[model samples]
Target: MSKSKILGSTLIIAGTTIGAGMLALPLASAGIGFSTSLLIMAVLWAVMAYTALIMIELHQHADSSATLHTLAKQILGKKGKWLASFAMLFLFYSLCAAYIAGGGAQFGDRLAQWFGVEVSATQGVVIFTMLVAGVVTIGTSTVDKVNRLLFTLKLIAMASVLMFLAPNVTQSYLLSMPLQQGLIVASIPVIFTSFGFHGSIPAIVRYLDGDTPSLRKAIVIGSAIPLIIYVFWQVVTLGVVNQSTLLENQGLSALIGTLSSTVSESNLAGTIGIFADLALLTSFLGVSLGLFEFLGDTLKKNSANRSQALNRSITGLITFLPPMCFALFYPQGFIMALGYAAIALAILAIFLPIVMVSKTRKLTTDVAYRVKGGHIGLATCFTCGVVIVCAQLLISAGVLPALG
Candidate 1:
């Protein structure tokens, strides 16, 4: 692959990881404070980045065309294939629902403010789904072009917001301690979600023709971009807004409204809005494209006689409809959806990678590039994933505290 394609694939990974989850960071980390959030983000980034390399390592032995499903069946057997399939669908659908819920709310607000037209959340969900679904149905090339354009705009808007908001940072706020116990534990699942670009690994592997050197570089650099962006984001957001204010903003819409109202620069508020919308849309396109292709492949197996165009259309509907309905009924499901996405991500990014890598290493010795740390490394990563899964479950069961 050429340098240009490498860069493009890198951007795809960064774009997918940095979307709706970024908006939830300040809110999720509010109770945990700035310093602790930084630590969690760093650890998760290391773990996730290592697992991504494990995935690339697996592809070294398998075909470039091999996806998570194919790899699971090849190495871990039928049960592993079923588990991998379920986790992929669950993770992708949960994320799609989140972006839809958050994106629709932002889209409706933009319309109401700019055109003086009132659009309900349900209507906004329909409009948002239709627009992105069209691009996805057209296929990956179209999604790539659209994602690049929006991702560029997202970066610019983010930089503009950071510049405008930097002067408002308070040292006292940055130094604040965790609001209550167990909040750090609760924030784990969401923090883990922010580093989730593992779903794009197989696609990246194929895009780079499974070139080990290039794939390794792409995964490391691509995942790192979001980590740096997220750290700076935490510093600026947590510094500008205190825990009390963050706690009061319950949902994405409320958080955006609060930021706009609290800031003195009118233009700053508008830029923040632009950044938020772009972030949501870019993330939406990356995720929906993956889900659309997965669904199309699954449908093709059952209906091989269907025309390609018709198959794509059906896949698009399956990809968006259930999530659209969920978004409409639960408009505030943005953060909650992300929490659930983390659970599925743990299974995909953490559990599957470790188990498959271990099994494959024992079964064959044809590996060119292997992740270090041996059995200890795999064991530690597995434990961390289990902790994240249990944390989310505990939070859901009311045994652990949740973010405001």
Candidate 2:
């Protein structure tokens, strides 16, 4: 693949990984050890990156148009298709709800600052969703191009924020809190959600025209962006502010608000909001691409079909509606929605890849890259997935308190 195509693919993967999830990371790492969280983030990145390669390995030998819908049917038959399709949609729906909630709140807050007017969270959700719907309904090429630009903007915004903070950091700003017992363990599910980039593999395959080397490199490089960003983000957050401050606020906006006043001439809050908004937009673009294409492929109404536009409409509505409703009605459910999404990731990104790779390993053309360790890695990853599911279940059952 060309450098431009590779960069675009990298942006899609990295952009998807670093969204609403990262917004909550500072708060999520409050009680947990920052080093522990970093270690967990690294492991999840490796696992998620490995699983993505498995998806690509499967995609390389299949039709160029094949997606989650196509692979599940080819590997696991009709029953698997039903299971995979529902899992895919359910996960994306949960993620969209979280993004809408996150984006709407950020957008509303910034707009309110700019105009000296109050924008309700529901209004924010509707505004963001309508704009996102326009981009999503247009299809992948547009999303790809738009998201690449958004990714660039996201970096610029982040760089600006970091630069603004540089003069403010002092030796007194650095402090380490004692880790609460069981908090590190409780944080795994939330941390796992931050490394989610598997859903974009099919889009990568299509975008790169099935260039295996580029796909592998893209997954690794794309995933690494979040890892580095997350580490730097947590380091800045943990060192610059106290855990008590994070505990008082439900979201990162509070931190941004605190830091906003540090500079008199600049609208730091608006600058921070731009980063959050761009992150939300890029993530929205990617998950929408995955969900719509998966549904369209399931119904056999892909870009090749005469009714492609109409098919995308149907797919976009199916993918976007439930989240829109949730965001409008329950605008403050960002953290909750993300916790639920992490629970689902155990099944879709974790367990499913293991099973798919194990079942299809024999069928894969030797030309494609295979997940190393064969059955051994699958067994290990499945065990890890089970542990995540169990932890999530604990949180759901009130055995463990949910983190922010």
Candidate 3:
């Protein structure tokens, strides 16, 4: 359980969790009232953190090479594999769509600012997709190397945002949010989507060589980083942009677009653009790698031996194309895409962990770590998962404001 291993592992998880899902945070949570929204984020943070631990616990006790797909089959058999595969594929694809769409929006804005050229959203997506898909297909070793570098740029640019906006903050902006009573439920899906670090559990386990203690440490530290960043990010974004504006531009595109219009200073808008581009790229790399590896594992395309490692390029197409389609067609639906992703991820990340851990405890009765609170905690997690899934579905069905 070395600190360096834990740090690197933590970054991997943090990078995975803190991506496109967050691009819409201030926009999504602003209308909920900063006070009320923080509460929701904290609750979901606890729930997602607890679920991540269950996943780590399950990973530690299972086979050395087991992924969510394989582990699901070991506990629940072929049916489990099918359902798990579907959930995982859909979740990653939906996230890819959101990230690509957001990245394109940023790219288009940057191009206009730097080169005085305007690009259509579809053209922007096509350009951004070509760049990101190239990086993703170059393989995981390359992604890991590049992600660590861009991650630093993302932090510096973001820190500047807080610094610039912090001085202008007024008590009025912080307390001025209009809390919609019925609309609060919409934030849950976004929160769930934001705190999604479960997809990287397998990578953390393998990175730490399945050291349960180190894995546990990574889960807590990794999740905490994003939680803290989100709090500060939301505060600054709230203070910078008026609360009344978010209520109008619920979609990530509209919300972020509104930021440029509201901020009078060019540097402020420029810094926001730089931060968004760097953040989206790093997030794209981390999550896409996680999903790509998951797909490889499920396809049985990986190997412990270097020589046996299958270089199936088609997997790249399968993983990136669906998202590109969504990016091309629904370029403005960043929030909508994330809400749909939450629906799929809730089943995979939350519910599965509870069921698998319960079965693991009953069958083996041996593990280095176990999630506390027993059945009650698990029931709470399950119930919360159901609520989030239903919330996303209801929004998608037009029963509520389609917050996208």
Give the best candidate by lDDT. Answer: 1
Estimate the TM-score of every prediction: 0.93, 0.84, 0.90
In candidate 3, list every pair of residues with a backbone clash: 251-404
Tens-place lDDT digits, model 1, residues 191-271: 899999887788888889999888888888999999999988888888988888888777888877777665755656788
- What C-alpha lDDT do the candidate models reach, one value each? 0.88, 0.75, 0.79
* TM-score attained by model 1: 0.93
Whichever of 1 and 2 has more TM-score, that candidate is 1
lDDT of 3: 0.79
Ranking by lDDT: 1, 3, 2
> What ranges in model 1 sit over 4 Å off?
1-9, 138-142, 304-310
Candidate number with the higher lDDT (1 or 3): 1
Residue 146 of model 2, lDDT score:
91
lDDT of 2 at 11: 84
Worst 10 residues of 2 by lDDT: 169-178
Give the C-alpha miss distance for residue 173 in model 2, angstroms.
6.4
